[model samples]
Target: KYSQMPRSVGGLNAAGEWYVLRSMIPGLKDKKVLDLGCGFGWHCRYAREQGAQFVVGVDISARMLERARATTHDTAIEYRQQAIEDIDFADGSFDVVISSLALHYVAAYEVVCRKVFRCLAAGGTFVLSVEHPVFTALAAQDWYYDEQGQRLHWPVDNYQQETLRQTRFLDTDVVKYHRTVATLLNTLMDAGFRITTIAEPQPTAEVIAAYPEMKDETRRPIFLLVAAVKPV
Candidate 1:
């Protein structure tokens, strides 16, 4: 797939709200970090900056990883070309595993979830940020202006789950799979991690003022964070 993932894929944000997201990470000092589906290695680079002994960025795209390596060679971040379902590390190898805007790409959720569970050390965290399922399903086919509303978004019809075709960053049309919040929880539990927290992130007022796109999502959560831990 020669898709241009939004610069957000690598940077984890187009508006630089990653620092806010990064705050959610418990701690990285002296940890072994794995940035799975690490397009362009942005998070991997940041992990090193946060004092991880080493940061490994794994991505399926060779071109994207190439650029990541070129831009981050001096930062002690390593890039590997690999799929999430088949990571090259040993079982229970990493202290922290994170994926930003990438988990949705895994069509067979169970297979990948198992991979994540097996890779984490006992009591390690699996923190990830992904598109909010509720907002996505609502917006899948309907587009209306929200000129006057109490919340960031008001659901036109809360019951319908529609399929969508949209252009990726490369401007190529792509298909996305939508799973509700309930399904997400069930999937994680089925995969063996103990779900710890599920949050629909709200952007700061400053960010909302700077980017109106976030306003459409803050109340409704266009993105959600999932934090889970592997059992001992």
Candidate 2:
């Protein structure tokens, strides 16, 4: 599991997908930032480094929080142990809310979206990334390989069906809820957020060259990113 391994912001975990997500983020200076499912608090520290007034990182895992707290030396950052769905904050409590590759584990994304809308100030940004529906629609959630160990094709099936999928990851059966791209967009709109950007980013040529295995990422998007704003 990623939690068991040392995850650096510079790591090539998702074929340099984090760089695309990080680039979309607006200035955080003097802003109060909230990070949902902030495993290991990497973004929390990032927020502080960007001169955010205060940063809060919430995750469900105690072990993850323990590692985050031990590693983080910033006084402006706070780590909380809480489920993403159970997060409660006052109205307009934060200037920005960000979630990275975390919403798929949440079955009730609509509820969380509503909460994020209420918690964010007017015109506040809500940026998030999730496993793409095309990737998650597969029950196995893996690429099919040829008999000679060459890469085959990424198979996608049952795309319209929004349900729980149990896929293996790092020898553990991880539960991820699958939702179509339409549903993902509509849910945010229903929560009264104005869509700003939708991205299916491809790896850069430099990144692809650095990691040849990531060349397949150019063929199909494995992640989806959306940035929305609460209307004033």
Candidate 3:
């Protein structure tokens, strides 16, 4: 169900993430790229189409990797079954690193940031999208609903308290780590990446018109997109 979400069509991803995240990306011509949590190899394939020299997609789920490999037919693209936290590549290994909606699941985002910083070549770009802190701060991971099942307002609580949050998604219990916007930005800066851009994406009027359910997204940010660069 997660993969089946309306993504990559007309440059929109779930919660309108890719709509903004895609614009944050730098050029990929002849660049070596790494995609963390590359479910179904969407970004990997995109990188190759953009003339990337090589692309490596890493995801912990074997099933995800299998699906990615099946859909990918390029020799220059490789899919690896590995957790983002455990990824170890030589220093200056990639010209670009991208992660979509993945970092919230990582308990040690700082560690992964450091790792990404180390692997990225100087002047390389790092772009990522994760569940917004506001959306994950509360255990419910949802909005306040009226008795008639109408969403009133998005609830946010204990935003400063960073910890693991257990929530339901796709009918499965999922654990995600919550960090404030400051913490998320600081973690990347602390890893030696220069803060370039940050976005709390909201749906376009056209998107809201297409999907009326997304109208409530204006009340709160559902995803956070960050772009940073390793200095040359």
Which candidate has the top score in TM-score? 3
For candidate 3, the lDDT comes to 0.89
**Per-residue C-alpha lDDT of model 3 across residues 1-232, encoded as one tens digit per residue:** 6665566333234446567887999989999999999988889998998899999999998988898899899999999999899999999999999999989999879999999999999999999999999899998998899999988899889898999998998778999999999999999999999999999989888778877878888888898999999999
Each model's lDDT comes to 0.71, 0.89, 0.89
lDDT of 1 by residue, 15-102 (tens): 4346555766769999988988898778888788788988888998898898888778655677889877677578988989988877
Q: Which residue pairs collide in model 1, if any?
A: none
Between candidates 2 and 3, name the one with more favorable lDDT: 3
Candidate 1: clashing residue pairs, number:
0
Q: Which scores higher on lDDT, 1 or 3?
A: 3
lDDT, model 2: 0.89
Q: Considering TM-score, which of the candidate structures 1 and 2 is the better prediction for this target?
A: 2
| Backbone clashes in model 2, listed as residue pairs | none
Q: How do the candidates rank by TM-score, highest first? A: 3, 2, 1
Go through the candidates in order and give the clash count of each.
0, 0, 0
- Among these predictions, the greatest lDDT belongs to 3
Task: Kindly list the per-residue Cα lDDT of model 2 for residues 178-208, writing each as its tens digit.
Answer: 9999999999999999999999988778777
